[model samples]
Target: MATMPRLLFLVPVLVGLAAPPALAQSEPFRVVNRTTAPALALHAVRSGRGDWGGNLLNRGPLAPGAFFALRPSEGAGCSFDLRLVLQDGQEIVRRNTDICTDRTVVMTLSGAARPVVPAPDGKPTPLPAPAAATARPGVAPGARPNPQARASTGTGFVVGPDQVLTNHHVVEGCSRIFVRAADGRTLPVPQAPASDARRDLALVRAPGNPGPALAFRANPVRRGESVVTYGFPLAGLLSSGPTLTTGEVSALSGLADNQTQFQISAPVQQGNSGGPLLDRQGNVVGVIVSKLNAARIAQRTGDIPQNVNFAVKGTEALDFLRRNGVQPVLRESPGEERSAAEVGEQVHPSTVFIRCER
Candidate 1:
């Protein structure tokens, strides 16, 4: 490597869970995949309001040229922001389009790379995420947040009944921690959370059922294997509901060849830290941790990097949970891969958007 990319910084980010099974993955409009690449996920949130309702194509990915017909919901409004994540981790968004007036939305890949298949490769109901959160200098590993008046938001997944997992930065310096499930419920964190800032992880205990806990993957992630990220990224700007992105394990080490962390190409923005990184089988492989500081790197190198994010390894998260005396669900990779939408449905009830108020 000619020059080392310096920073692997952590920040707050999040996503909402999906409606329970009372509702299915069907939405109110038709989405046609007119691209050569398979679509890993599709989401439609009511244009300017509402979290991402659910993965519209939860049953499976939309094969190239396949069209999914959504019968209009009785009360879901007409306008929506339709986002599609392709297998190569490219997102094509059709924003604020009326599903009622334009009943069919056709999508085509926007000339992003369609690579050869590499071997690997939300929700709870939600409360409206804070209209905004205050940002500050990030906390260093094992360092507590300085007492302040700003709140940070991050994503967390259920590791067990009533146990939500997230990054310590999301909880540092907060007067209180609140978790929003997919079902429009706001859960209060009753006790002080168990945290390991060294690993950048925290476990918050909230009351009520958290649906099925996500299973951690039994094997190590392979370089170039496809992975999916589910979190609430840019909720203040994008939909607060679960946002999904797909990409491959770019490398097996982090900045400075950190073994406890891994490099991924999945796009993660502020408010996404602490979310789960899943394999094609919906097994939790890592925790969405941080991304390179692009502007700083750009100034140093005269070029900017894109989608260079990192995650804490699943084994590290598992160790943290066990140290906290929480038993987590674990699973081996199944023979088949699931569409990102399917993973969202299976784990939606288990994922929560975390908001920490200082």
Candidate 2:
């Protein structure tokens, strides 16, 4: 019997962080297909804003190893999210990504290509394939894969048993959403409570029992205090578990002096949205939201800034939960600090992987 060709979803590891070329700045951003397989459709959108801008490659398929430029609307900023559907029906998505920073994104596909065939009705019919297969192959037959595939990923943490807190943008427009615990158990989330889109926070109930709920910090966050973030960035594609990065509270206000957020120096990636921003004592201070656009900033001031990321202030989340009639556990900041490793262990159980499907 002939084995089926393994479908590959090749997304650039750091395409979101790619620095746009300054000298040859053309359209704000564009995509280059470096993969061997044809991209059936491509869609781009401004992060945290509107719908998938529509197919940039027109109504036709993008040939293998071809590229095209994106024409975003007038107000579409440098930060964008992308979705590319392959000929095999497998989709590769990068969310809340900064494409304007990098003028060109050269996408690549791995493994063999399965050509989509035209049906008897004259419509193109893509070959049936696994939507997402990020887990490592081989093991006992029918054994659960370590890291399962997801349509799109975001970061969320346990606030109450069967209750998770995340950005509304993370789960917005999701027909189906699920939460994957640090232990690798996938829990379905059918619906979300009323969300505060202005503040970008939402709370959803988990279908299964969850780990220890994370505690929030009551007092205000100060500038220059050490902080850390934990979440699943790139999920099965990068690491099989949650990732951690450390930094300090760069500022008390968000972009444009927004009082509902904070500026941090910790590095954040596409999947880091909605993850917990914990202080040194492991208390939740904020939710990872977004980062600055290096390309846009460079266009404004002939210099490229680094490590300027933003998070929704924990107090905002508190108010939203209170409005929803759910009282979250709150704790005062600890006088003494714990080691980074200790903090990670204490909070890792409560951190979870959030997936959205439509």
Candidate 3:
């Protein structure tokens, strides 16, 4: 039987006007295809605010290293969101750039080449270079030391321009916390006054100057609903940033005690502590704290217990930040955000597989 090839999606945001004057010249952009299989077909859709318009389809297959040119439709002051859907129903959605005047934008589509593996002969083999490694700073020849190589894995996100939200256990006794952004920028977490220890949360100022603006969600989530979790699991084995995992709400209330925390069915591993749990719409729902271990409970109670996990509620985190005058931009979902497959190909480097050093 022939195995089906995986479909890839690329959501490229093109900003500019759709008028004749704007279409006269085009700006250049790049689209990288990060999949093992060749793209059988490519399609693009234009949308704005809440309206989705017509779609442009590419009939031919976009082989590895192929690039496509996107042209704007004729219209003045019309803003659009570009969505790319692959043959297998995967999508990449991005907000279109605003049109200042009539101008054209050019974009290039780059494909991910398949990796080369050697046969079982115990011989060294070569592999294709990965799509650019998320932007990393250059190290001098024979540099004395690299802090990140010896950093600890912890769950954290920007709460302010340079501030981060995480658990005290994550950075507990470490002399310093090494923070990395989704874009592959390395940063340092400066010591900040710890919050109420009962909550197990703390604030740390992210180094490297200013980073992405902090965002928080105010909507409440219910049980059995879909949710996504992000964090760095098995540190050192993986790079640091937002790692995405999907699961459903197992329980809304707490299992241990009211002071414990809410529980989610999401499967989180070691090094994932203190990561954010987001809703299907990409809103923060809670912060992953720990997984419910039946074995541990069984050992304590002399009986096997059910497995469960705990998370710090988003509402609680929001309240703490607000009362402390953190003032994060709290916003409700615009409607239904794009699905995982529709969002765009996620770069795995954005996620770091974490492992402890014994």
Reference-based lDDT, each prediction: 0.70, 0.70, 0.49
Single out the weakest 10-residue window by summed lDDT for candidate 2: 1-10
TM-scores for all candidates? Answer: 0.59, 0.62, 0.51
lDDT of 1 by residue, 169-206 (tens): 56754556678887867777766677776677888887
lDDT of 3 at 171: 50
- Per-residue lDDT of 27-109 in model 3, one digit per residue for the tens? 32333334433444333333334434433333455444444445443322223344444434344433333322222322222
Clashing pairs in 2: 20-101, 20-102, 20-103
Tens digit of per-residue lDDT, candidate 2, span 1-358: 1111211121111122211222321244556666656787776655554556446655577776666665554435445667677765555555555443456665655432334576799645557544332222222322332333225678888888788988766775454567788888877664544566678787878757767889999888889999999987775568868889999999999887989989999988778888999998999999998778766677768898889888989988888888877788999996798887888998999998877653
State the local distance difference test value for candidate 1.
0.70
Model 3 bad stretches (over 4 Å): 1-151, 237-242, 298-307, 334-337, 341-358
Q: Which 10 successive residues of model 1 have the least lDDT summed?
A: 1-10
